[model samples]
Target chain A: MYRVALRMLLGDKTKCLGLVFGVAFSTLLVCQQMSIFFGLLGRASSVVNDVREADIWVMDPSVKTIDVPYPLRALELPRVRGVEGVAWAVPFFKATVQVRTHQGMLENAIILGIDDASLVGVPDAFVVGSIDDLAEPDAIAVNPAGFRLLFPGEELDVGRELELNDSRAKIVAIVDAAPAFAANLTIYTRYSLATQYTNNGRNQLSFILAKSADGTPPEVVAERIAARTGLKSVTSQQLRRESIMYVLANTGIPVSFGTVVILGAIIGVAIVGLTFNQFVMENIKQYAALKAIGVRNVKLLFMTLGQAAFVGVIGYGIGLGIAALFFSTVPKKSDALRGFYLLPEVAVGVAILAAVIVILSTLISMRRVLTVDPATVFRG
Target chain B: MTTATDTLAVRCTGIHKSFGEGEARVHVLRGTDFDARTGEMTFLVGPSGCGKTTLISVLGAILSCDDGEVDVLGHDLRALSSGKLADFRLANLGFIFQQFNLLPALSATENASIPLVARGESVKAAETSAREMLESLGMGDQVHKMPAQLSGGQQQRVAIARALVHSPRILICDEPTASLDAATGNTVMGLLRDAALAGDRSVIIVTHDNRIFDFADRIHHMADGVITHIESPDSSREDAP
Candidate 1:
């Protein structure tokens, strides 16, 4: 019967191919868009991911995502370091300021101030002079992407100078950091120099990046720091999740992607449903003959189910394969598409969604086959 | 008190059937009593809309009647659940349709193997048996051809092979030769008569083709939802001569 079902389904080449197309198109659309949406949300917490050495982050209680920084008073760093289980703490400064490029164009930049002595928050990768060069007066480090944005098509080199908040600043080193969600060039400078450059008042510290002592869990130390200092202390993972949640709550990204996914599902149901129903109707007499010859309804039901399963698995496999290819191929066009990959949970979710689409499409045809009278085969 | 004779393949009594409702209602089978005995080919002849097809449909248990009784192959169809009735049909009955009704996607051999498959035979065994039957019926060369590739007469032979492959006791055919030429009709009728009369099997054919009337062992004439007469082929032939 499964052989019979396959032959019958494949006999009509157009309709069978149409069914596969419907399932494949939906899987590709929903799965690909969802991955991109996830990747974009992940960018909201790139800063948390960039500073790998910190076990926990301390900030003003109102701070939400990394982009929306609530500056802490400089004195809070020593308070956070004094808490038990705190191995060490460093003052971190982040501020948005305008910089005048050599071309005289003013561009927005995110200024990151690492501790002067330890250079603890400096980017992990350096394309030119090492972190020691930051000791030079008015020295700063800029990432490649921000450098290009600040000076389009310029040759990569150190010693590029620019004006920050009316103060002269020199690019002594080049950092290879990913672009943050704020879509601004990131500038790394010494803490005091960053303060002078931004020209903010004395309480310019944005956060306290802390490490846990040996044998002390980050979560416990974060709890102690929060309880003692009356400030928000979140482990790296917690802060990343909070940043993602903030983006989810405050933006329309989910709803926008959600509507497209729903549309894909509906289109799949419509195309596959109509095509399968048409196939069954065209062969109604043959089914009636089989029914009349005493083939049980359950057997026929399984035959239909088997056909749907075949179409679903094939369609989903092809769709997912193409989606993976897209994720691999699209990044070459731009750097923004970097760091995108399909999540395993999303793969499972899309597979289940494809199965549901296939099942839903065949239901009408199954009912039609079930209700048909065997006597219909005898009719003129 | 109905009795099932050892030779009786079917015993249907006072059968009633209707179609549609309200102003469009039609009582297609009105108090019809019919029977077919083992080792005989029975032909039910009637004009269009005379309820010949409907009567056989009821006898085959493809449709339940509005009233009265149908006992086929020793089981009262009304007394059996639908599931059991389906099992009974699979085990004891077969059907042939006028259109040959072969699944177009299947080859002639596969189409003929359907009844055996319905009885839970494996594809390899069913096709082996179907091939032997087709070869015996002179369709050996056509077994692998799809129905669309076969001539009408060849297709009907496959239908006949399908009907007999499962060794069913009762075979019902509706307008079996209405679509064939006179010579092809005779060929199909010859095949059917040979298959049905070979053992304790009974065949009931509802048709308007007069060319194959010579093949029937007993002719049951029907008119306006009633059996008008029952006659043997020998008696009809004597009358004709």
Candidate 2:
């Protein structure tokens, strides 16, 4: 029975290849596009994740998204410290400004300045150099990934310098592979440098980064700060949503990605459906003959579904693999493509759509299956 | 219930079937009675679309008659549920279609092994039995050749081998000789004759080829879904047990 089923599925090379390719194309598009999109989103909130490092974050008033203005880091820092469950409170600086580099005037860099003493907001991985390098005045940390982009495949020494703001900053550290998602070109500087860079105009930080002591819910600390400081506080998980909510609502990203997703799903279903329908139509006689031989209906259905799954899984995997390879090798300067980076949850969501399309497209032809009077084979 | 006729391979009476509903409804079979006992070869011959295949499907348990009594291998077809009817067919019936219907991707031996494997036999044992059946039909050397690799005559022989592999009590063929040349058709018909008559089982071939009529122990001609005439080699074809 398996032999027959195998024959039924791959009997014709043309049809089998068509099915595989249809699935492959769909997989590639969905994976590659989504990877870059999510990669960008991760970058958009890099400063928040870096500075807070906390289980929770509190914002000013009813702030939503990391871009929202918070009360001066000086004023809220003490109020958060006064909270019952509070273990630690620190100031974080986030702003975007143009930076002068060898490549060009790179604009809208998410500038972050962690307090001079703490250094809590630095990139986690450093491909080259160590943290002690950031200790020097007029010194800053640069991502090796960015350095490589400005000077491809070449290493820059610590003494090398780039001018940002009016201050002449020397690169004391070259951090390798620090891929901060969005801030792939990030340069780490002291809080004072950030103050001078932005001219101390606002005189306030983005928000506060806090850590709760043992066995304390971040919600408790957040509520304490909200009641005492009255500067609306939120947990890190809530901050993550707050960080993304504005960009999602204000920007046209949802509409754009939503359109692309719909197109991807439609094309996926159409290609697979049309191609697989051809496969089944060509094999109709074999199915009829199998029915004549007393092969049960359910078994035949299983074989079809199994073939579909084979196409879906293999094509999806191969497509994503190819897409990922393409994305990884892409120069950072290229239009930000993360290439279908998704967690298990995202993969499941994508599959639900594909599976429904497959079943829907195939179900239309099942009528022919059920109607296949075994007598047709007897006559023909 | 204990009559000696209980040993019969097939017994049917008053089979009725229809298609569609209300104004579109058409009766295909009405009060049709038929039989093909053990060790006999019965041919149900009719011209195009006269319900020979439909009747065969009903007898093969692939189709259920609307109202009838059908007893095959001591199991009442009308009484069994749809699933059990399929099980009965799997256990006892072997079918060959007119088109030499072998799965294209599979080798001839694999095609012949389908019934046994469908009945849940292991692949190893199934192919072993398939090889034996194919060898009996002179397809032993071509066991591993896909359907495309074999000539039409060889493919038909493989089909015949498949129908007989499970040692079914009833072997049913619809136009088994349709695609073959006269010589090849005769060879296939001879294999059927030997398998049914010599082995004490029954073979029913539904074909209009009068040349193969003598190969059957009994030939039944049908027109408009009713059996018009039935002639047997000997009246004692279904002798009392």
Candidate 3:
């Protein structure tokens, strides 16, 4: 009986292929868009957690996310280090300054400050003259991804400086692949280097990034830290989702994806329904013939639904394969596009989508197939 | 009145059928009484619009007579529910349409085995029986042919083989030879009569082709929704001349 339905579909390969590709195309469009959208949300908070590799983030109690507060001082670091589960605590600094690029001065270059000793916030990409230059007072490091945007052209060995708030700073080591907080155009300097130009003193600093003691739950330590100090403490994961939601909610990503998923489901209904309807309609004569010779309506129904489900299966398998191949071709720098997790999430999502497609369309076309008049077998 | 000559395959009395009512009523079969018996081939002969096909359909349990006691195999159709009637049709009767209706997607063996397989026979057993039946009917070489691949006579042969696959108590054929030439029609009629008479299973063939009158063990001539004549081997009109 399954073979019977398959034969019917294969009888018109062109039409069946048209429908399969139609659904596959729709699935690819919707799933890739979702991956990129979630990837975008990931980008907005990548530096706040991923770069620092922090287990917990301690910020002002009033803050919902890491971006809410300015850089904090070395004084709070001591208070946090004394906490039971705290292994090491690092104070990150955020300072906006006028960057004098060879192209033009850009205003929103987010300054990331970490002292040279632990360099807890600095990633391996730090290169060029080196972190030792941070001891040179006015030197700052910039990630290579944003290096060209910050320094547009090659000028002679001359003094080019960026002024933060009031004071000036010089370029130091260049890092590679390191993430930035606000936008891609970022400059990193030592805490002492940034402090020279700091107008707000030790009071205005970014959240404290912390690594917990072994066996201590980051959530439990975060709760303790928030309770001990007047600041709120969130695990890096919590802050990651919160910071992402902070940005995504503004961009309405949730609403957009909700719409796409719903539209995806409806498109599934339309594609499978119309396709199955046409399939059964074209093969109705065969069904009448089957029925007249004593084939049960239930058997005919199974054959019809079996064909629809087979299409769903084939289409989903093809679509996911295409999506994986597409994702693989992307270069490593495409962090935004590199985040498709085909494990539990996509497996469940595609399963739900395919099942819904099969079940809905089978039921829609079932009414027609079941009511077929067996007497029509005599007509032709 | 039915006789002890054979168990009544079908008996319809006061059968009335109307498509609509009042001024729009198209009475297809009105007050038609008919009978088909086992151990004989009953030819239902009538002109177009004479309701012979409708009467045959009623006999086959495909369509119910509106106001008649249609008894098949001693079970009164009006006394049974629709579902029971359908089950009776599936279990005890077989039908061959004028079109030689066979699922084009199915092979000749599968097509012939539909009734037996559908009634819960194992596929392997049904296929074997169907193959043996087709082989006996001289369609052994075309067992794998689809309906579209077979000639009209071949297709009709496959239909007859299917009708007898389960050894049905009665076989009702509607114009089984309508689409065949004289020779092919004679061949098909011979196969149908032999199938009916060989097993003592009743057979009713509804057709207007007078050329196959020799195949009939009994003939009920119909006109204007009425049985106008009953012909038997001894009293057949062909013997009068």
TM-score of each: 0.92, 0.86, 0.82
TM-score of 3: 0.82
lDDT of 1 by residue, B1-241 (tens): 0111348898888889999999999999988888888878888898999998888888887788899889898888888777777788788888999888889999989999998887889999999999998998899999999999999999999998988899999989999898899989888888887877674688889988888877877778888898888867666432211
Best by DockQ: 1
Residue A222 accuracy (lDDT) in model 1: 100
CAPRI class assigned to model 3:
acceptable
2 or 3: which has the higher TM-score? 2
* Candidate 2: clashing pairs of residues: A31-A340, A35-A340, A35-A341, A36-A338, A36-A339, A43-A182, A56-A236, A65-A242, A127-A176
True contacts kept of each: 0.62, 0.67, 0.28
Q: Which ten residues in a row have the lowest lDDT in candidate 1 chain A?
A: A331-340
Q: Estimate candidate 1's alpha-carbon lDDT, on a 0 to 1 scale.
A: 0.86
* DockQ for each numbered candidate: 0.65, 0.52, 0.33
lDDT of 3: 0.73
* Per-residue lDDT of model 1, residues A282-375, tens digit only: 9989989998898888989988998899889988988898898888888544556766777777789999999898898788889999999988
> Model 1: residues >4 Å from true position, as ranges?
A98-107, A122-176, B1-6, B21-24, B236-241
For candidate 3, lDDT tens digit of each residue in B1-241? 1122477778888888776778998898888888878877888888888988677767766667778678788888778765566677778888888887666667899888877767777888989999999999999899999888899899989988888898888888888888999999999888887878677788888888888888887788888888887888666553210
Q: What residue runs in model 3 are displaced by over 4 Å at the alpha carbon?
A: A48-53, A66-87, A94-111, A122-189, A192-203, A211-217, A331-336, A341-343, B1-5, B17-27, B47-54, B76-87, B120-125, B223-228, B233-241
TM-score of chain B of each: 0.93, 0.91, 0.93
- Which residue window of length 10 is worst by lDDT in model 2 chain A? A331-340
| lDDT (Cα) of model 2 | 0.73
